[model samples]
Target: MSTKLKSVPNDFDSIEVQPLSDIIGAEIRGVDLSKDLSPAALDAVHQVWLQHSVIVLRDQRLSDGDLVRFSKHFGVLDFGPNMAWQPEANRDHPEIFVISNVVENGNPIGFLGDTEVDWHTDLCHTDLPPKASTLYAMEIPTDGSGNTGYMNMYTLLDALPDDLRIRLDGLQLKHEDAHTLQGELRYGLNEGDLKTIEDAPGPVHPLIRTHPETGRKCLYLGRQWNGEHRATFVDGMSRAESDALLDEIWTVARKEDCAWYHEWQAGDFVMWDNRCVMHRRGPFPSEMRRIMHRTQIRDTAKPF
Candidate 1:
């Protein structure tokens, strides 16, 4: 008998995969998340997600059931503790985290303020920040506004000068939930809401985080509103200096080529890796209506 085993057939040759943009995102056509996915198909999806930090699937036509089924294909899902928009969904599905501006009574709550949302990763203050997040647009504003922007941190790191990259190696930074709370309260968080936020413990992480899957180092300086905690430095710099340095970092990171903007459409599902990317929501008219459902994937690894 021959020592070599018989050749096995590959089933993924039929799937259609295409990149959305050269630098960041991809669109995987012809895969139905509603149906049972073969191991090969799941592997293909995983591969693309790793390659392109963000993936957009147009016309997914996913219902709540479809969304839940699709999310399970990735890893364990995380329903955030803080309430945002849909409380009923939270109660029914522990896997899906809701992000919306609508109240329980079907009234539209406009943006918390007219100001812009700064650059930040989701759930960074938690012990296990979300690995990925998926947002489905149910309704988009009529005006050509409310664009969601994303930055490819991996590309940003690649563009950095060698000296800066070397300096950021093994640096840590203090991440607090206080700023998020302040934003909420500034927008009118009630006493009960404030209590819930206070109970959640804050976490610290490396200023330059290493992607567990890709093994790439990324700038992890998120949006800061309150300046209370100590700095976690990788280059042995003081807090004030670190803050100034971060401003310089943002100047490079927020360049047009390093980022992509997505104009929302109904039934579009947008997913991005929180570990290696930062996102921001654009300003939209307060009078117009916009609603979106978000589900965040749980991070299996502990916070660095």
Candidate 2:
């Protein structure tokens, strides 16, 4: 898509807001996230995020407490998935989720180690998924590893084929909670927990969900693993039928026209709306080390 200029909000008069792409991302300059933002400035950032879906602030040096404090301006904090296994520094802050490839004492310092994470929303398996997610870069590989990409779901929905749009009107999907995005079973789960995708335990949500705030409808394909027993599929449909439908949806959703990628910098901070966007990470070399701290904003209600 081509780039276009958007008028900055009145509260953004002191900050420099630059659009990263036509559809998805914006970079906000001249703001110190470590210090508390004025109410007007915080609202200005929120407005930019609502318009762009994702916002990046460069050269931000934030501690775990600073990250939590800034993220709370958006909404209530949600506990990270690895709260039980947090590193020493993060043990005091359960809201901080560590994403890293570093191994210390023969144990990973964080999750999603060095592997490419495919397209998916954050915690969609839950009945009430997060409204937004934030990530702060601490250490990054020198060889340009771990670039993150984001897709604009609203634009994707608007450009959907008529047949597919019609098919999605009333369809609901089961977001499988049995496995992680990397196709591994979650902690304390076992093979006996789920026998088939048909009977898997998870949240049932509309295939196309309306954003509670924006009131815009968008496709919500939680995640589909490449295996005979997939994680997410259309609810109540036969396995074959659901697979065929999902295959069609993926063909359109995976198009690069509405996507933007961000290369990580040591002091970069990124926050994205989980309600109307999907994201993925590129795989990095195993020998490289990348450390990132993340936080999620809790949603007040379940998706309709």
Candidate 3:
């Protein structure tokens, strides 16, 4: 007897999927961000992103316009409120978030004077978080530094022993907008700027979130920090006991193989699902330059 198998489509002229790793990201080749993509091409890219959780397109050659256009294909883009960098871009393009350690005139912004960011999903403090985020690398550091690292929450869930998975089922945690950055307050975010974030009420979500698209469970601890609370006894445990539980879970979640590190290069674009991954940026030299433009896609569904 003969068996037939379906083949992956290779019809799109604009996009190509090349696997970067067996478990995480794919490198999409032959795509120019400047031009609009056909529905077929867009669908193809979306399918791969869902399957891989992260996708990197090299040599994208994006302008601000291109960044917005490419991002819109996925969903409505939501630019994060300014607390980090490029406040001007936040004002002009409501859909673009600029990530850079350089001045507009091509000068180093000096990392020593700036603050480092921690691992967290974009907009997780809000009731509605982003579905995915795309960052375009415009000028990368020369010394192979300033790489972004991503941890796969899906893998985190998979790695958990059966007993732990059963333990996390139906558990909920509170995510809040507590101010952790002292430097941000010192830099003078006005009442209006601060109010925008202050109004963001904390949300409660399952400890193990099931992806609406893929229907797979993922560990959903957005950022394991204080001020965020978890209910331990259904009636909820004391803050101290809950925090210790989270610390234990985080220790298990952060094993080295569950993460992938991407060294940035000029014209590299990285996009990942906020639902199934958490990311952080590494420090680079104070005198080196790096600029990145980001567009975030609003989450379409709630994490039950």
User: Top lDDT: which candidate number?
Assistant: 2
lDDT by residue (1-304, candidate 2, tens digit) is: 3232333344344677788887789998878899887787887789878888999999998989999999999899987766344444536788988899898888788888888888889999989999999999999989987899999999888878898889889899988888888888877878786787656678899989999888888888787554234578788888889899888878877776778999899999999999999999988999998999999999998988
Each prediction's TM-score against the native?
Answer: 0.80, 0.91, 0.81
lDDT of prediction 1: 0.67
Clashing pairs in 3: none
Name the better of 1 and 2 by TM-score: 2
Identify the superior model by TM-score, candidate 1 or candidate 3. 3
Identify the candidate with maximal TM-score.
Answer: 2
Q: Worst lDDT window (10 residues) for model 2?
A: 1-10
Question: Which segments of model 2 are wrong by more than 4 Å?
Answer: 1-13, 82-90, 226-229
RMSD of each: 6.8, 3.0, 5.8
The C-alpha lDDT values of all candidates are 0.67, 0.85, 0.70
Candidate 2 lDDT for residue 151: 93
- Candidate closer to the true structure by TM-score (higher is better), 2 or 3: 2
| Model 1 bad stretches (over 4 Å) | 1-13, 81-90, 103-115, 181-201, 224-236
